[model samples]
Target: MFLNTWSLWEKEPDYNSYLGLAENLDEKGYAVSFGDNPFDDDKVGEKVYMHILNRADKYVHIITPYLILDDGLLMALKYFAERGIDTKLILPGIPDKKAVYALAETYFRTLLNSGVEIYLYTPGFVHAKVFVSDDKKAVVGTINLDYRSLYHHFESGTYLYGAKCITDIEADYQATLSKCEKVTYESIKKEKAFVKLRGRFMRLIAPLL
Candidate 1:
């Protein structure tokens, strides 16, 4: 006999607010690891989706407060979308850092045009970095879809397979949809010039964020 344990990572400081996984576990499911790989660039962002999300036949879901997609991850998303994968994003409508939000906004048009569905969480900032695909797999941890998180920060996430919490993540996603505003090309274009300019400036300095 073996003891099963699961370690989950979160960007939030609240101990009580981590993902709810109790009702979703079973004998076959086990713990996903936690901690950092300090020596390497954050390859978790690239690999998580490359292996898990790319294989989804239903949908690829993401929930994060801030977003800044690099070339490789962006290309991977486009590739997945082109193959008919429903790649959807849920981001913060109210971000803690305006500069990061501005930077994230600059890429809205490109992503929307490339067929990625973007949603803004309307009630508050959503700092959770979670990814779920086809309700079969999930990655929950500290990884973010930005240059700093993917290339600089020492981050990690737990990769789960055949876990019942995959559905819980999706259910959370659906609940979030009710509080979200969808992004469109026209909406991106409609943003004020000053805001757009700020986004461009933020983009230049994004690697430092």
Candidate 2:
């Protein structure tokens, strides 16, 4: 990760500084993998997410601030949910970016119809970017479930397999879930017409968000 950051630095590049820091950290026993974009490839983060989702057997719970998915991810998620895997997503109720939130809302109906559960944090905005599945795998990082983060930004995340921290991550997800309001088909039907229209318009330029 440090090497990736150092390589990304264009002005006053200092490779030795990052190398020095990297040399001090000792390897551990936990099965952890790092995924970053641009440095490795634009799809590094997306591949990590897809790999986890495809391997999940029991459940997959995700918390993301934004939700602008491409065809591949959209299909993968829908397939899992349709197969009766416990698929759930937590999104922000109080949006930090209204336009982006509207765009995200455009996906609700499709996902809901596919049996993917949706929750909105009612107390405030949910900025967390986390994916925990099957109590054995989890990812904690800066990558949002949006096109900008997946394909355009320099994002990174740690993929944890059989790590003890997976329990704590799932625990936090449950605690946060208690504060969220589950979204239902009825709720989507009740959404304001103007909001729906705005979301539809936002989809046209989602890649730039």
Candidate 3:
């Protein structure tokens, strides 16, 4: 498995893309025992979604421009860390939107200190949403795991089987880390007043914004 062969999407947030995938999976059913919560409505069900994170025992890969991991997300990640699951985060060092990028630093700092690893990508904007667990399944598509993406705007990702595509995604993550800087709480403390203030503000509205 090149790591990426497991899952793939030709386009980002292709509506029919995820809908089609859901139909296929529905038809295919589960050869192995599985748990799924269909997102009929727009809002992301926090409890169920977070639970999935806590239960993932294999490998978990999440790709997004920003990682404002809620407490549940953090707890699940901590679980992954304690058990020594292969955990990696794909993040962007630079973002197309200046405001979000500035605030993202704080979230990055928090996660890095908490033991979740981060990888920054300097190449343009990264708008891919992908979460792959182990060599078995992956979700790739237009939705981001952020407040706006998950709740406000509609989003979708198709779960896939196999390993090659996933392997490639992992490889890309690793290669990105080499070009990226690792964040730490200590480093966060070294941030300028504006950055610090921005982080403070972001946290205040963290849940809704």
Compared with the true structure, model 3 gives a TM-score of: 0.67
- Candidate 1 minimal-lDDT segment of 10 residues: 1-10
Q: Model 1 off-target regions past 4 Å?
A: 1-26
The whole-model C-alpha lDDT of candidate 2 against the native structure comes to 0.82
Superposed on all Cα atoms, model 3 deviates from the true structure by an RMSD in Å of 8.4
lDDT per model, in order? Answer: 0.75, 0.82, 0.57
Compared with the true structure, model 2 gives a TM-score of 0.84
The true-versus-predicted C-alpha distance at residue 103 of model 1, in Å, is: 0.8
TM-score (C-alpha) between model 1 and the true structure: 0.82
The candidate that wins on lDDT is 2
> Cα-based RMSD of the predictions, in order?
7.5, 7.2, 8.4
lDDT of 1 by residue, 93-175 (tens): 88898878988998777777778899998898998888888887888888888876777777767777666777898898889
Clashing pairs in 1: none
Per-residue lDDT of model 2, residues 88-162, tens digit only: 999998999887888898888899989999999999998899999999878888999998788878777777656
Cα displacement (angstroms), candidate 1, residue 205, comes to: 2.5
* Candidates sorted on lDDT, descending: 2, 1, 3
**Which residue runs does candidate 3 get wrong by more than 4 Å?**
1-52
